[model samples]
Target chain A: MIWRLAFATMLVLAAADKRSGYQDASPETRAMQDDDASNPGFLWVQQGETLWAERTGNAGRSCADCHASIRGVAARYPVFDARLGRPITLAQRIQQCRVERQGAGPLAPDSDALLGLTAYVGLQSRGMPIQVSIDGPARPFYEAGKALFETRQGQFNLSCAQCHDGLAGQRLAGSVIPQGHPNGYPEYRLEWQGMGSLERRIRNCMIGVRAEPFAADSPELADLELYLGWRANGLDVETPAVRP
Target chain B: MMRRRFLVLTGSGLIVPLAPMHPARATPVQVAALIAELVGDATLRDERVKLDLPVMVENGNSVGMTVSVDAALGDVRSIDVFAEGNPLPHVLRVRFGPRAGAPRIATRIRLATSQTVTAVAKLADGSCWRDRVDLLVTLAACID
Candidate 1:
């Protein structure tokens, strides 16, 4: 009888935990939903689609003038740049395009242009599963990415694992926390009036963890983005996703 | 002796400031109702619906929120989320395929004000589950 009672108690606790957003799988279901079909994100996607084709900011070069199509480009992002020999996120790719290709001034990370371009590029790989390289030169970055995932620092003193890996598929207040997947970004968070870059989202979480948010294009953030893309290796791309 | 005197002085000093206190007020129920309407027939049972929010949101603009359901895959079909105080209460509706693995999701959201958030879960066997959570927002994060 005592053993049965103890077992029941444990089950209740487990259920309670699962009901909280303490599990790694908490974000999975939300990532797949299509709630905001009429949201401004769609509008941004349309605008971004235009920007991807239009030549602007003095170089007479639109994103389309050089790159053939966004299809293969999106899926192969966060790649190791031999010049930097480090990973570069999709946002960084746009920055590279603007500075090196278009001779346009670099837009701030959260600027509408960056958000739109990221969303537009991300849409091109809509159904492709994420594929970050984890071998050869990408190995060191993968390790750095993994290490960042497990480290605990900041005011809350809680690590990413505390919520994502250690307590995945669990709840915190009353919502089910999904897995840490970048599949649904550059998402259209209702919280943000329009589309947001995946890097901005990461910065948002860092604030939640009480860590000092990195600058938009900082190497630390790039490393973290690399890890996120690799962590969600097999999930389908759902850029411009809608969230509550 | 000095430390002892300071301790005694502190003890006495602390007692003089006793004042009436009020319990933290609970969030209104309309927010919960809004969530219910958004989720449809999914019932609000504690067993299946899981809702997560910070006890105190730093700002209402982009509070992190998550919702999930616990049901036998065969018995659970879909889950929906609603933020009563958000500009759009119908946050998300997640359907599970046999291949989707588990029923779970998470995302950051905007809350227009301090309000109760709810999640409703629908089971394939014609049953429903629900849960509601109260979020205290010291600084509203969503609207800005």
Candidate 2:
């Protein structure tokens, strides 16, 4: 019993140690992510650049037509959309633009075009601190996301906090557990051999714990994303990050 | 009884080394044969080729990697990368055009476990340069 108490105290102290995903990455991975020329995720970012300039749908307008520049735009995403009357992620906003503004068909989740555009937009905000607001109207969703982050589920009876928050920096099945931060969505994953969104990654975690994942664009995922954004409050975004 | 137990322990020790160290996977000899088949009888030197990979990978599914050869090593023809521990060792093969200025390629690859990743470069002068880095993959990829 005394040993159990000491282990619990150790976990609590470990949670206080703040480290970014980059710090947890191997040296080679960090080098690859740090350089644009050597980073594979840039391939998707390049594709996104092309799509940003090309005219699409009946609107004959591109993403560049209105936004002009995407600099620092992604850092403020998963924001409360006044028009939608709810919090929406960057991926949802991209879909919204396609359906409502562009007149183009909605791109499927995890599709190349969607990932490319998201990576490109996210790349623009590289190194900017995440600044998501969970105040006023966004407060309730934030609360729900916090509840989900702490709630236990799955066959393993594990919560996100169990590993990411409590056991972060420790080895699990040989890999170090990192604090579950969403600063690098639309990031390139070596395992996937492609770029993926934060939602896809979250679903992957759910599956890892033997839990049924929420569908793409589910409120649960969005709220969880919002909570993660809040968790990573001041961490600089590293979009298109190359992860193992 | 003590003598009988001692004899049994000695016999077991003798049998252990003969047993396969890694079962259910290709052996190092097999992986070397595959590399030989790819590179042929070319003289593989250790210079010029550079392989960059994480020393420790948290997830085997998406480990970042970069392989490059010194441009000073004359005209380069192609580069082949291999992950000896993966289910399929051959990760990628990149060929450069005649006008290709620098022979540099960057990408991500999946690893089955902790193992050495090798890169072999074929140059225009009919020579092959090789380099390898051993890395730890915490999580296995290609598994559901």
Candidate 3:
């Protein structure tokens, strides 16, 4: 009976820790939210809306001509892509669209086109909770990512858990370190001069850990992104989110 | 003070063999002067710019950042990015049109080493806004 009570207490503490800050790891979203009057995602969405209609490459096929409206498309991303036998991020899917449908070359991993399209698609699911499925094939990818997150890397000898999981909401230097959530992506990073992809952002963190950055389309990044998406399961997609 | 490496361009199209330098020397002043030359007629304020950077970074290859100003985007016409001790001081320049909604940007960058990062914003009225952040880099990330 005493052991059971101790276990229950530990579980409660863990739950409270997660509730307090780990859920929203990125900088506060409110600062970037310009109200309903000015949606930052609006700009990227307009660009994507245009691209969806415009034909490209030799085939001259536009993504919009076939799929048509993809209003809720964003919330379903980082899905278990059957062919790859792993979870695929929205950026990966967008690249596939260009390569398979349009027969065009893959955009540079974090290229502006990829970021723009990812932002565009992500906005379609704005205000909807990110609902990546972790049940089937996605389970393996999530597991792989979780392992990677806990693994320490580079000369810093720090794991992703150190800052995001362990010390989240605490000040590192002067900035309030966020929990490292993946909900807001295809974000318009102020320093980037334009839109940015989750891949690039993930790569940024890799560098922070002093780990060598994987190639833009590397399997590792895909797995890591899947894991992060699953972790942020119920959070709404806030693509083109502003960060500071 | 920041550390700087003298960059030698190699045949492989890569920068090689980083040679360290003193930040308090003439290098940063020259960089500042060069920036001043690039942006003419704008005032440099000690207050208006707010630069966010880490206090201690293990690597210089990727440094997180945030920059903002209290002024409206319409009132501002230009912005520039500078790393006082990096190999190249002029990182980027942004010119805004009337439709440019905001004057804030947050992104990641490469700092050769620990140093002060500054952003100078020039308004349409010929006034200057400047912000500086002291970043502590424990391990320089850009070893290559």
TM-score of each: 0.58, 0.75, 0.60
Cα lDDT for residue A190, candidate 3: 43
**Which regions of candidate 3 are displaced past 4 Å?**
A1-29, A35-43, A191-193, B1-144
- Number of the predicted model whose DockQ against the real structure is largest: 2
The Cα error of candidate 1 at residue B94, in Å, is 31
Tens digits of per-residue lDDT for model 1, B1-144? 001111111221110111123223333465566555654665455776778887666445555667777766666677877666665667778887777667777776766667777777878766778778887754311121
Query: lDDT for each of the candidates?
Result: 0.63, 0.77, 0.66
Deviating ranges (above 4 Å) for candidate 2: A1-17, B1-25, B31-137, B140-144
Q: After superposition, how far is residue A21 of candidate 2 from its true place, in Å?
A: 0.7
DockQ of each: 0.06, 0.21, 0.06
What is model 1's C-alpha RMSD?
14.8
Top candidate, metric lDDT: 2
Give one digit per residue, the lDDT tens place, for model 2 in B1-144. 001111111221110111113435555677788778867878788989999887877666666678999865347778998888876788899987756667888776777778998999988877889999998755431112
Estimate the overall C-alpha local distance difference test score of candidate 1: 0.63
Error of 2 at B74 (Å): 7.1
TM-score, model 1 to reference: 0.58
lDDT per residue as tens, model 3, A97-173:
88888988887776656666777777778878777777876787888887887777864666676556665565553
Q: What TM-score does prediction 3 earn? A: 0.60
How much is the lDDT of residue B35 in candidate 2? 76
Model 2 chain A scores worst on lDDT over the 10 consecutive residues at: A1-10
